[model samples]
Target chain A: MSAAPVLCFDLGGTRMRAALLAPDGTRLAAVEAPTPAREGVGAVLDGLCALALRCRDTGVAPQAAGLCAPGPLDAPGGRMLAPPTLLGWRDVPVSALLGERLGLPVLLENDANAAAVGEQLYGAGQGAGSLVFVTVSTGIGGGVIVDGHVLRGRGGLAGEIGHMKIAEHSTDCACGAQGCFEALASGTALGWRAARVMRARKDGTPPPSGRDVIEAARRGERLARRLVAEHGRWLGRGFANLLHLYAPDVLVMGGGLANGFDLLEPAIRAEIARSAMPSYRETPLLSAALGDAAGLVGMAHIVRQSLPDLGRERKLG
Target chain B: MSAAPVLCFDLGGTRMRAALLAPDGTRLAAVEAPTPAREGVGAVLDGLCALALRCRDTGVAPQAAGLCAPGPLDAPGGRMLAPPTLLGWRDVPVSALLGERLGLPVLLENDANAAAVGEQLYGAGQGAGSLVFVTVSTGIGGGVIVDGHVLRGRGGLAGEIGHMKIAEHSTDCACGAQGCFEALASGTALGWRAARVMRARKDGTPPPSGRDVIEAARRGERLARRLVAEHGRWLGRGFANLLHLYAPDVLVMGGGLANGFDLLEPAIRAEIARSAMPSYRETPLLSAALGDAAGLVGMAHIVRQSLPDLGRERKLG
Candidate 1:
């Protein structure tokens, strides 16, 4: 293994995160910048290149670099095939472009898959033998780790948990599907519910934001509590499906909503217990340990595996 | 690899299957018999031994023997642990018992995992990088093949697909769960639906078996057709969930209902297309190529991996 740290970048729709990770999985330095994603793919690429160069100048000219972002993607080909959240980006050759710009081999992975790997290697799933990581964010995304290797399925595009049609009549998804888990459960869906409840309130209650709803639930807001419980039920239902299909040793929850896992976990666990096969009832579900850093760290881990010849590969640029 | 033939057995609750397989993947002989399962675990063991002795008497004593049955099991320790379908079979040291009786090493595998391994080596999943297998029979069972290995999860009980919650208000399952995929869409569930519809019929139609429902649907009986369609919808929804979670290269469907797959395929595929992530529309759902032979063949396949010293380890007993 290279002793030099791996530079990791997590590219989101609104934020660009950068980190330098040591060979022993330690984070040395990290920073974040606004991602002007609306400026299109070119601007995003430029931002990524600048971020890597900044990391290099700060004494972490990485042996390699890892990038994590949303999909529909070609992970093996290192291309983004028009992720729904990122507009005007289609078949972007991310890895090649970064490799050329930074003069270093770059590995790209689906953000959720990266986070799952990071958690499996260093977070809540550290001791678990097999795991399924679900991130219930604006939408749901999943990463499945079995026997230490992620199940990338056929084309490195595995683990898209949100689009699964768990509900027969919930709502239509942007993906043109009805009753998807994400359509029914995600943070965005929760926010939509909260807004609708506020609109229908005869007592003239103020509309709560997703964060506000979570906070109010904690503070004993009845409507907020009911809505969040509904979210938890949806989450639990999805988790039950996963437990049945994978029988994972652990189910780890990550992403923004996981911050209030204490509120969500009980309902999720109850659903899993009530829905999963008896033999699978013992599988533990835990909150992610790395928090926001998971994407960067997971990308770093993927980089080591994907770009094995990082330092030794003949540099073209 | 050993050139000697391996004896493989698939011990189901109702039937016993055996085969002699050469190392080159050719079957020398195949045999079947009634399982005698109702007589309890000891009778099952004696029946298995009798089948092995019959195989030996007919020609070659196997270099090793592999047995595939239901979960929960200890594959590493070769013990059967309280499988619901196998009454009174609790922590039976099957491998030890079989080895003692046959004077050869014995290997045990969960039937689903065995089927998955079978597919990877010789069935529809051959040459595929990853595959997920689901058997929609009286119950739902899942097996995952990632890269070239069967994903046994933490302890050999990974891939339990049938119990995933597909319906929010599905009936209680024998495993003491409600809303499970099995409770909503298994062959048994389909039968139940047919019976309920028949009871509600003004024309006084007889209640249908699962097979009868399939035949009636094929003949275009409206109620039967509707029942099949509903079952297909559930199957599709469940597959959509599985697709999002695993994104497998290919999904192989097996079990008794697979015979009517032609009747079920179109609706299932259509529902999946309607419910899945847009990018995953092209993922294939296929009928298993190995048929009922998968269990027996898979046993031989897993034995070759788990007990490397199968032919070499001779027992005087």
Candidate 2:
């Protein structure tokens, strides 16, 4: 591996994280700030550039950079296509703008895709020829790797697992669809279910957030436990669909909800055992290893790979 | 393109079809026979070899051969792993056995994958960079093509779309799963639904086959039309899931049921319009162009591609 480092950014709806990562994936410097999404695309882009400069000023001049953001993205074109969370950011040419401002070649990837690559190369999915990585946070998202590369279908829109409809009929998803996997099983869905149950009790207890429900379950609350189990059941159903579709070498679970994976594993496993075909029943499922750092590390590697000349030049400030 | 011909075979539970196909996918000669499934593996292999010999005698000697079969296959190893349809056969090395018998290297592929490749190369999916093909016959099976190659996940079982659990709860599938896409929307499922409705009516009429239901629907029978529409709704739900997962350039529908695609297209389209994420809503839905000849033509091209040396040799018998 080259000793040269790359700047990496993980741009999310809530926060934007930047890091200066060595070629081997060590973070030499890192910084994060709340996203100015409501202020429009220009402000968010400016903030991202400022963070990149901060990481660059840490006395280790980076050669290239990689940025991972929410999709729907035109990855090859390096444009973000109106992601729900990134308000007012429609068809923004992020990669070109960032590269032009920083004077470095930058590669843009979907956040979930970057995370999948990160886990595959340095985390739980290491050595797996193909992997399916799913992150269950406020909503669900996923990425797929096949034959050591991300499976980017037409328009680089493959691996949009959250929008997959898993139920015959149920709640509508934010994407304007009914019975979507994310609609039924996301953290938001769990909170919604909890709120409905609380409302039905007539005890005047306020509705809990998704995090609160998880914490309540961790504290041995019966209702919270049942709710979590139900969430796991939906997750397992979606997981079974992924298994059938990808038959991946490994399936990695990540994101906020995965913090309580132990509590969810039994229900998830049971549902998968009931739904997946016999041949797929033995597929290994594991929690992600790199956690929050996955996107940064993954993007760093992607940039290094995309701009091989950066490693050879090794320009020092 | 090489002028040499290749032999192709599509082996199914009910029948086995063989053809001598030119490099351009023309059928120089064709033959088929009922599969002797009850006569054991050896008999089936012998029958397959006999059919190959008959095709070889058609004055156009094939350079190589490709065979497609129902899967759960170890495709790299060229072995079939106990497909439910092919009773009494487990881990049968069809490629090696056929190659040895014919003195030609034979390539084995999953039937659905072969069909998908066929459609992409020479059928409705022509010019598409990637495609998802679903064949809703006795059961619903699928194949995915990405960047012009088959998406063969681990064990070559990636295209088992039939078993994806689409319903939260429903009747059990032959594979012992409840609410599978196949269990809810397959031709067999349609027959089951028709039978239940007929029994409820008590009009002294015998139960209708899935084909009878389709024919009745085509002839404008109310009950049969409703059944077909319901089937289409289930199909659309499954199609939406596929759209979200692959976002393929095109989606091809084939198999026996595809003969009635015109009847089903309206409902399928409506459900997709309602359920699919907007980005994927415009993916072209097409009927397979080559009909039953798709597998044969596709396998011929695959054989040509896999054994490039065969084209150079110009073996004329």
Segments in model 1 whose C-alpha atoms lie over 4 Å from true places: A203-206, A309-317, B202-206, B220-222, B309-317
lDDT, model 1, position B233 = 81
In candidate 2, the residue pairs with backbone N, CA or C atoms under 3 Å apart (3 or more residues apart, or in different chains) clash, namely none
Looking at model 2 chain B, which ten-residue stretch has the lowest summed lDDT?
A: B308-317
What local lDDT score does residue A20 receive in model 2, on the 0 to 100 scale?
A: 95
Worst-scoring 10-residue span by lDDT in model 1 chain A? A308-317
Candidate 1 overall Cα lDDT vs. reference?
0.81
Docking class of 2: medium
TM-score of chain A, predicted model 1, versus the true chain A, to 2 decimals = 0.95
Compose the digit string of candidate 1's lDDT tens values, residues A222-241. 88888888889889888877
Query: How many steric overlaps are in each model, in order?
Result: 0, 0
